[model samples]
Target: MHSTRPFLRDLSDSRRKGWEDGLRDGYAEGYFRGQAKVIVERTKTSFPVRKIKVLYVSSGKGFPYSPIDEAIVETLKTLTASVITAETKEPIQKLAEKNRPDLVLALDGMDRPVEQIDAVRALGIKTAIWLTDDPYYTDMTKKIAPHYDYVFTLERNCIEVYRGLGCRNVYYLPFAAYVSHYRPTLTRSAINRKISFIGSAYWNRVEFLRPIIGGLMEKGLKINGLWWDRLPEYKQYPGGIEIGKWMGPIETSEVYSGTKIVINLHRSPFDETVNNNTAKIGALSPNPRTFEISASGTLQLVDSREDLSSFYKPGVEIETFSNSDELMEKVNYYLSHEKERQQIALRALERTFRDHTYNHRLNQLFGYIFK
Candidate 1:
């Protein structure tokens, strides 16, 4: 025998080790499976089948498109609601009269007529209006919002303003992304841009971007939006740089997917050129782009806002910048650390799909009002 005792001992030890490892791995796999099952059950329970007839009033497609309006309507459809859409005041009345829906929802009601609202309420159906830009259009909104049965506002801080206007059923409804319109890409886009910004060239944005323009361009920066090209101040960029036009929702998602870092500069309601009044300047909540960029599966670098943490965990899910210098510093750092950037982007995308989709928002609305 070739040392039979030693050979037997070695074989026993190896088998013991293998069994322990297998046990550990099997336990982990079983635990994760249980967790996943729980999550699926929770999701199934959250979305109960709800059927209601709704008449939707929107600005419709053209210049200054409202993707959020489209998203809300689409999400309602998934809830088994029969929806009839109207662009303007005239069609809204005609549709409401023909359909006799159980409820009427007017989205972005700054352009809606008070007479039309009265006409819909005359049908003995409940009327609701969701304002995308709350304090920005409060002067007109305060005049009309009190007439509706329910009022939903994107500006959380302005809930009291509607209440002050003697509206009883005001609710805080935040902005969200349409998951289908914005998502991650498996393959990289054909474009070569590294960092991108897509927003209107408001005064604060123009001024904030001026300082870091040269440095960001050296590291590859691309910007696209309305009025960005028309601005003379931004013309000083390097020869290859040019401000591009506004993109549609899907094209905007494509730009975000192609970039490494998507910089989001929120509009100041005080910027009269943009918001017409500075009343809600202190209100610092994120705009729709904040969720859209995260949903696009790109690392988002946004300006510091008070309510950002309620949506994303800064420095973990997304990065925030208070000034141009900080933004430039982070841009360089994140670009060099590819693994960390990708991890954050992945986490953000997961969060967006789990909590910030339009489907989730619509469910919240229905749960609150319908209950």
Candidate 2:
């Protein structure tokens, strides 16, 4: 009877453990199903006029935190889209299936792996890939071009490249600023001698600026950015120049307003020829810095590109330079001719207000999508 009692107790414990495990599994399954039902129900509602549900996938690298996330969300709100962001491809696909959004926007060049492309495509949703960087070095176009409904490139040369690659739909959408965020303040004050450039250090930019440092210094230019740290100790020059670490988007815009002239130099790694389909020598692409600096109502001296004339009337809206000599000359000319500099800045502001807002881009995007 004693032995039988021990065996009976063991059997009872095993049965109790099995029942608890079953309960836990049932709870998990129920929770997932409930969550999925909510997502599906939310997606089923009728979208108001001009409202598109956009699923934007980002690697969540630089601006994944709350502040940046909030800004991106706010920008998307202007489009009246229910914006959802995900970091991984699997979750994004799952969301895409559950939500069945009208459109999917991928932030970087390559947001999904090759394996998941079929899953996303299977959803029968329109996919747009936003290329922030040059696509030449990456296999984004080669691997995923066939799956995308449309490809929007910041580089103009990419239109032809993607078309050649059998992407029937390709558009050249240059980088733009949120006009509401980056705009001229009503009060204009005297300019101090602060000059800044904001971007990561790249080999091409470092090499290009090396020979021109002396010219810039001779003209009393105060240069700042990440390039200072990358310079050799012996070659590095010191003086009134201020070097800044990475600045957030808001801080960067504030810096633009405080400075007298903001110089925008494209890094070699991102230059048009390297990543664009245009002939290496003839390739021209304007980075977002052009629009951001101009929108802030700050005087800008940008590296000259042939395509820039298409966007803004050269010598009227903004000034450009080809080499170090040309850059220094423009810097001096603009500084001495303050009225002309202000005029160009104002023209840039006007042009951007009329044609280059994110709203404008969204309109164009939707037009193409519906067409």
Candidate 3:
């Protein structure tokens, strides 16, 4: 009898790799991907989504981008024969071989399986990478993106940068809200209300918040992020700065819902301490949190960006703050005028849920791929 052990062990090797991946990426992260695959496989029918088999490769090593990866996976599951793995690197080839997906859409090129990308594409798998951190990490993305058949950047400024680097099918695809998770929530938590900001204290942010720190504190501000020590006033307000604490999707959405105004300050691209954009391609697009904050039914007071208006209508659906004084002035006005703030938040929520979501973003991606 020909021993079938070789084939079975080969299959088991893949599962064993999953176990190793689970150890690296915690149990819940592993369960989320594995269980979702199981549930989708058991279903007798799938939605008329793209009608293509896709293998999703995620680079969310955990923190901020993890939820984004999960949202993308949930949307991909609606398609036919979707396989997911956070294992990244070497496993991509083995999984691609087993799954035989028509397209391999990798989220965030920073941590993609660069060496094996050519091999996967050689197997006739159409490769695409939707770059989450653009312009900022161009030093790295510029190298990784050329490996893909299609390149999607969150920053419009990088479209030309990639196109110039010889990536043929470059597209400007900004991040969208994971609507199901980021939708409006009831304000039932111990979170502070007047004003809030959720992101790292990048040197640029540290300096930007310097002038308005006192005013923000007076207005009952609470920040949930890391590296606040960069701010000279870190120890001045114990309750105001949450140094080194990271918030997940659920808690972040809750904070946004509870807060009257959530500040969306972007990290400076030219800051060498934090970014690898040696070429210093300017950033023009809003961050992923812009849609998430609006979808959470909170007034997003984002910093000015050239491409911000294209996605969000400022002063109506959203608000823009150019400098610290302007941001402080708006914060004071919005805090006092509850009706105006609520109206803007509601309008932004309607706009975000209507036009900006992972589903909408994916549809655009598929259109470009098929076209």
Candidate 4:
């Protein structure tokens, strides 16, 4: 009788465990399905994506833009029935003549195939250019914008700039993370870094960071980008700056994941020597790095911009600063108050995955084009 009772109890326990496991799996599957349904439903009223064919062109520029163009192409593939890719270095006109796609979409206005874009438009094919580096390179982009059927820019302030140049289809489309690559894929190191900045040392950055360079050196800074040698105090911080090494999206995501705080400072619109913004258009929108840092699950200390709050909740999803003094204080505070910093990072990560990814950005872009 005792042996029989033991077998019955074991059987009952096994059945309960299986039931719980099944319930958890069902919940997860249902949640995923629900999320997918929401995205699909959101686009139900938009244009029929399956009918369009896009010729996605990338300049194949190294560093920042190549990865971005690749991500844009990947998302475009899912949106359209067919996506043919061509490099600006190659003859884009020949591909357009061959494929005769419904629309030809190019990334970055720099190094444009001017004649080819004109040729594609002559073919009665809709042509669009998504300008990643806006306002900064507006000197070149202004000449390139009027040729395309649609002109999209990262800077909100440039919409008027483009429209003023007679490009009627100008739209404000901001940068976003390629979510599959930019995520917290790695665990933080045993010793967290106090701060990190991964971008080129433009004239503005050099001037803005001069005051706090000494403070940053003592706080464990990892600076990697071109032209750091331009900083006046470059020699002071030995072994702190790695000049001319570009961190691709995946590598940057890893750094963002391991670090405690990442600084994202926008380039100076007024610096003519470093930038080609002859028109002096203010770069008010957040750059691509903003979404990348947030999506990578790090507490981002970004500088103030006009459209910043439109994308991220101030002091909730992201932390911001107006100048070097404010940035230094936030860096110190977030470094010591680990729990609060982590909470903001977590919230930003969630917000980024939900709304600030390539998929989200392209959905908006396609809607505008097809509308």
Count of backbone clashes, every candidate in sequence = 1, 0, 0, 0
Residue-level lDDT of model 1, residues 1-371, one tens digit each, is: 47545554666787867766777745743443343334323433246557788888885544454676778778888874588877653656677888998778888776777788887787787889888776676667778798798998888778888888888899988878787788765443555468998877887887888877888878888878766754455666634244557788888888887788999998777766556344552566788889999887779999988889999999999999999999999999999887688678877877887898877887787777789
| Residue 150 shift from truth in candidate 2, angstroms | 1.0
Model 4 lDDT per residue over 2-22, tens place: 544555466677786776677
How big is the positional error of residue 262 in model 3, measured in Å on the Cα after superposition? Answer: 0.7
What residue runs in model 2 are displaced by over 4 Å at the alpha carbon? 1-49, 63-72, 87-90, 109-111, 188-191, 218-220, 233-236, 239-244, 269-282
Q: What is the C-alpha lDDT of each candidate?
A: 0.77, 0.65, 0.81, 0.82
Error of 4 at 65 (Å): 1.4
What digit string (tens of lDDT, one per residue) describes model 3 on residues 1-371?
Answer: 99755755766777867766756545533333343234223423223566678888887477667898889888777654555564644568778888888888888867655877898988988999998888888888888988999999999898988899899999989989886688665423455477899998898998999988998999999987988988998799898888998888888888887787999999899999878989988988998889999888778999999999998888899999899999999999998776688778877877776688787888788889977
| Candidate 3 accuracy as lDDT | 0.81
Model 4 quality (TM-score):
0.84
Clashes of 3: 0
How does residue 68 of candidate 4 score in lDDT?
Answer: 88
Please give the lDDT score for candidate 4: 0.82
- How many backbone clashes are present in model 2? 0
